[model samples]
Target: MNSSQFEKIKNGKGFIAALDQSGGSTPKALAAYGVLEDAYTNDDEMFDQVHEMRTRIITSPGFDSSHILGTILFEQTMDREIEGKYTADYLADKGIVPFLKVDKGLADQKDGVQLMKPINDLDETLRRANERNIFGTKMRSVIHEANPSGIKAVVEQQFEVAKQIMAADLVPIIEPEVDIHSGEKEKCEDILHDELIQQLNALSENEYVMLKLTIPTKNNAYKELIEHPRVLRVVALSGGYSRDEANEKLKQNDGLIGSFSRALAADLRANHSGEEFDEALKSAVESIYDASVNKH
Candidate 1:
C-alpha cells in the first residue's frame, strides 16, 4: 500500500470522481454526454467512444487532484492508455489517486435488494489492479426497501468482499446504495446505518474501510459511521438526484463527500468544443467540491 495515497484519501479535502460506467450503464452515460446509441456500431466501437470521453475528461484542465481527490475506473479504462501512459499512471501523475470498479455488476433484486454478482476472478482482478498502481476498489449493491434481512445481507456481502480487497492491501469503498426512489427510504437508511455500524464495530482497530452511500433522508444520518475508527471516510453517491439536488443535500452532511457520476456530468455535452467542455467540467467540479469540502 502507498501510505501517501492512503493518507490523501483519509484526509483529502475533495470528492472522488466516479467515471467507472461499465458495460451495463455505459450507453446511458454516453447518451447523457450526447453520444446516442446510433453513434456506435458495435461494442468495440462503443467502448472506444466512451474511452475517448474518459480520456478527454482526464486530460482536461478542469480535472485534477486539487478539487478531485480520486477517480474510479472501469476495467476497460484500466486496460487502456492515455497520453502514452497507462490510465492509472496518468491519474497518479495528475495527483489523483485511481480506483478500479471490480464487481461484475448487480444480481437480480431478491429479498427487495440487489446484491453484487459473484466476481469469479476477483483475485486476478486485484492482481491486475495492483500491477497498474491502482489505489483502491469500489463495488455496489442496492436496497429497494426497508427489509432488515435484505439490507443485512447486502451489508454482509459488501463486507465479505471488502475483506478480500483489504487483504490485497487496497482500500475498498463498500457501497450498499438504498434506492433513492424507495418508498421506505428513511427506514431503509436507518436499517442500513445500524447494519453498517455492526460491521464497522467488528473490524479490528488496524483495519480501515471507506463507504459510498446514497445521501440519507436525514442530515448527518451516517455521522456515527463517519466517526468510526475503522471507517476511513464516508462519501455520498448522487444516485438519481440531479446535480443541484445532490449538491444541496451533500452540503447538509458535514463529513460526507461526493462520488457522483450523472450529477458530475450533468452540464456537459458531447457536441461541445474543448473550451466549452472544460468550462462546464470546471463549473461542475467547483460546485461539487464546495458541497463536499466547504459545506455550510
Candidate 2:
C-alpha cells in the first residue's frame, strides 16, 4: 500500500465494524432474525436478508464517522445502492472508509487449523474495489489450539493473501482468531506472537500490515507487535463475548481497538422505530468508543 492509502486507514483510528459475513455466516444471522434456512429457495438466499441487515447497519441512527472509522462489506453489499446512493460512496461521504471482505469463507478443517477459503476471483474483486475506491480489505482464519504448527499455518495463509491484497493498494486486516474458550488462550497468544514476528521478517522491506486478533488472554500479549513499526494498528474481535464483556476486555487492551460485529451491533432489531434504533446504536457506539480510546 502507498503512503496515501496508509494515511487513509490511519485516519480510521482503529474502529472497524465488520459486517462482512459470508454466505455460511449469513444463514445463522438470518435464523437469529427468525428466518429459517429451509424457507429459502436456494442456498445463497440468506444474502438477500444480509443485505437488509447491512442496510440497517449503515443507515442505523447515530452511525457517523466518529462512531465507526470504517465498515467491512460483504461482496454483495459492496455493490449495493441504498436510496440511490452507492455503498462505497455512501460511506466515504460520511467519512467512514469502506473495506471489502475478499476471502470466500473457510475451507474444511485441516490438521486442526481452519483456513479461509481462497478467493479464486480475487484479482477481479480487487480491481473492482480499486475502481470503487475501497480503502482496504479483510480476511479471517481460525486458530483452535496452541499448536505451533496450526498457528503457523493460519499465519502463513493470512500473510500469503495479505501480500497480494497490499499489492492491490488496499490495506489488509489479517485476522487469525484464536478461540477464546480454548484452555490454551495464553499459550496460543505467545505462539501466535512469535509466529507473527517471524512471518513479518520474511516480508519485503518496508511492507506494512494491520492485525485483527481475538482479544488475547493478557491485555498486552502482543506488546512487541503493537510497537512494531510495520504494524499500523492492532485491533480485537469479540470472540463470542457479549457486548458488555467485549467492552471490558477491549478497554483493558492498551493498544487494540475493536473490529467487532456482534458487540458493536448489539441486539439492534429490524423492527425498532427510527428513534429507538438510533438510541440503541448511539449507546453501542459510545460504549465501544470509550473502550477504544488509548489509555496507555
Tens digits of per-residue lDDT, candidate 1, 68-187, equal 999999999999999999999999999999999999999999999999999999999999999999999999999998999999999999999999999999999999998999999999
Against the reference, the lDDT scores of all candidates come to 0.95, 0.80
In model 1, pairs of residues that clash are none
**Which portions of model 1 miss their true places by more than 4 Å?**
none
RMSD for each model, in Å, please?
Answer: 0.7, 2.1
Candidate 1 achieves a global lDDT of: 0.95
Error of 2 at 58 (Å): 1.0
> What's the TM for model 1?
0.99
Deviation in angstroms for 160 in model 2?
1.2
**Alpha-carbon runs more than 4 Å astray in model 2:** 1-5, 11-14, 33-45, 294-296
- Residue pairs in collision within model 2: none
Candidate with top lDDT is: 1
